[model samples]
Target: MDLNIFREYDIRGRVGPQLNEATVATISRALGTFFAANGAKRIAVGYDARESSPIFAEIMHRELNASGCDVVSIGMVPTPVLYHTVYTADVDGGVMITGSHNPADHNGFKICLGKGTLFGEQIREIRDIALAAEFAQGSGTIEHRNVLNAYCLDVVSNVKMGERKLKVVVDAGNGMGGVTAVPVYQVLGVDLIELFTKPDSTFPNHHPDPTVEENLEHLIQAVTEFEADLGIAFDGDGDRIGVVDEKGRIIWGDELMVLFARAVLRERPGATIIGEVKCSQRLYDDIEKHGGRKIMWKAGHSLIKAKMKETEAALAGEMSGHIFFADRYFGFDDATYAGARVLEILSKSSEPFSSLLADLPETHSTPELRVDCPDETKFKVVERVSDAFARTHEVITIDGARIVFEHGWGLVRASNTQPMLVLRFEADTADHLDEIRDEVEAKVAALIAATAA
Candidate 1:
């Protein structure tokens, strides 16, 4: 089996080549062995809307059961619902079969051990175990449970909307988000304008990823045409969110965190709020200004979640829209719950959604840019870039290279899931934003070329 599928945060790769029946069975057996050794007896399993997901899920169920794990089949649900089951159901561990914003031809697994997802060395350990192939043996059983309704109800219960009903636009991009989130919005009495609510593995409307601005065109148009309160879009498995304001202006993840952090701070003074290094500096500033402790940590949902628990943070979020709220809910990243929280904030206020951040300092930034780089060499390229900047400039090397400039900041990090280099830049002015981004991109390109040579 191709071991590269064992990523830093989860197991993921293209369907036919890197993942198939044999590979899936081997991964399942490996996971079962790992979980059993870790004292996990009952395992919750769920798959996303991808065509290959059900097949893989079945393989996992059979393999896990054969390996002495009683499998709780949660059926086809979003990634977050699988996570919800891990906490709500009587299970010792959970596995979500999802590619999570990748193209339709790809699929992967998000493994949850105990209450948290594994990352870094934990993922490497699983890969090592898979290579060793010392199988654990036993006969286990499989039980099916439909938890979508219960999950929706739980989300609805957490949101206390005001008397002002909301007219909202949602673009699910034909992924798993609409399957679960639509019901919650209807129950909340939202005047919902939905696009692509059906679960199609083909992703007929567009790719399910909302982080890329191009993927949100339909959402932006619908929100503007409807003049709705706001627009929300979810990634393939519904773990991440992308939002637009009433005027159809896209509100990036850092901006969303600003709203969430302020509300959380009001309820729990001095609460800790964690933002990844990719987040805008304004988010950290806002957290501190609102009497909440601010923490800037590494990216990736599993890494951020671990940090949140370590610091006992009330809230944590990524620039990629993985928002976690531990203040009044589970700390795991759930776009459905995050959407409800956004509506709750809007319901209580008479101001337009865009106005919520009107008082903050203005800045210009770019959406995350993914540049192709081989997984084997991406880290070295980033290290070289970091070293070059560190010689004469201030740089934060916690995750990759976050070079601090006088006017703004630029980041270059190797993606944990895909073989790519992720880049982002922000500055107080548009001109500075261009300057910073150009400078950083040029340096990155040179390093990548040098590495290739």
Candidate 2:
């Protein structure tokens, strides 16, 4: 097994080369051995609609069983459904076979151990055990259960959308979102417009990643044509949500948190909210203004979830569309649950969805920018850039380096999932945004050159 696939957040890689059935089977055995040693006797396993997911699941089932753990197979569902099963079934561990926003040819696993996500060094340990051919001897049972109905019912039961129903659009992008979202939204009594809701691993209409504006074009258009109140799109596994207002304007993840924060603070004053460093500073300020405590942490859903657990934050989100609400539900990032909460907020208000945030301080911000730097050198480049900036500017190094300027801020962070660096900038004005971005870009380029030299 290639240890590189054992990322900071989850295990993922290109399907043919690194994530083939045999490779996943070995990794599954490793996970099983680790789980059995940790006293996990019962485990829940699920897979996405990706073509490779089922094959991965079968192998995982046999391996986990071989390692002395019962496998609860919740087959062919969204990633969150797998998470739901783990909690509902009271399992000691869970693994969801999903590639998330990556293209169809790439796939991986999101794992949970004892009600919390398994990540970081924990994932690396599995890789080490896999390479060493570690094994535990026993034959455990396997059971199949369909938890989709229960999961959907649970979401509707928990979320109070109020008496007023919303007219909404849901674009699953031909991914697994439709498998669960369709049922949940239908029961919510919303005037729903379903687009590309079919489960097609090819992602025929658009990519499943909602963070990429291009994937949301069809969603935006659907919102306008349907004249719906708003629209929501989900990633491949349905954990990240992308929203668009009635006016066809994209409501980013951080902005969505701000909206959720306002409502949460009104209900529970002094609530703690967590946002990633990549989020606009405005989000933190808005939380403070609303009598809420704000914390900016590293990017990545697992990292944010861990921080939320430590901080007791009611709400937490990343710029990439992973939103977690611990106040009324489990702490994992579940876009399906978030969509209902969003509609609930809109239902209780008379104003347009866009108007809720009209009072926010406006600023020019750039979407996340990706720069291709090999995985081995990405962190080094960030370190050099951080050192140079720290000498003359205030830099936040929680994840990578975020240079704080009087007019705005610029962030350069290593992408946990890919061989690249993620860059983002925001400022009080367009010119200032450009200035800071250029400064950071030039410094990054110089460091990359120096590293090569």
Q: Highest TM-score, which number?
A: 2
Off by over 4 Å in 1: 451-453
- Candidate 2 local lDDT, 297-389, one digit each (tens): 988787888899898999999888898988788888899999989988999988889999899999999998999898879999999999999
TM-score per candidate: 0.96, 0.97
405 in model 2: Cα distance from truth in Å? 0.6
Per-candidate count of clashing residue pairs (backbone under 3 Å): 0, 0
lDDT of 1 by residue, 1-453 (tens): 898898889999999999999999989999999999999999999999889999999999999998999999999999889999998989999999998889899999999999999887878888888899898999899999999988998899988898788999999999999987899999998999999988999998899989888999999999989889999999999999999999999999999999999999889999999999899999989998999999989999999999988999999999889999997888999999999999999999999999999998998988788899998899999999999999889999888999999999999999887789999999999999999999999999999999999
Displacement of the residue 140 alpha carbon in candidate 1, Å: 0.6
The TM-score, computed over Cα atoms with residue i paired to residue i, of candidate 2 is 0.97
After TM-score superposition, what is the CA distance of residue 153 in candidate 1 from its true location, in Å?
A: 1.9
Instruction: State the lDDT at 218 in candidate 1.
Output: 98
**Residue 366 alpha-carbon offset, candidate 1, angstroms:** 1.9
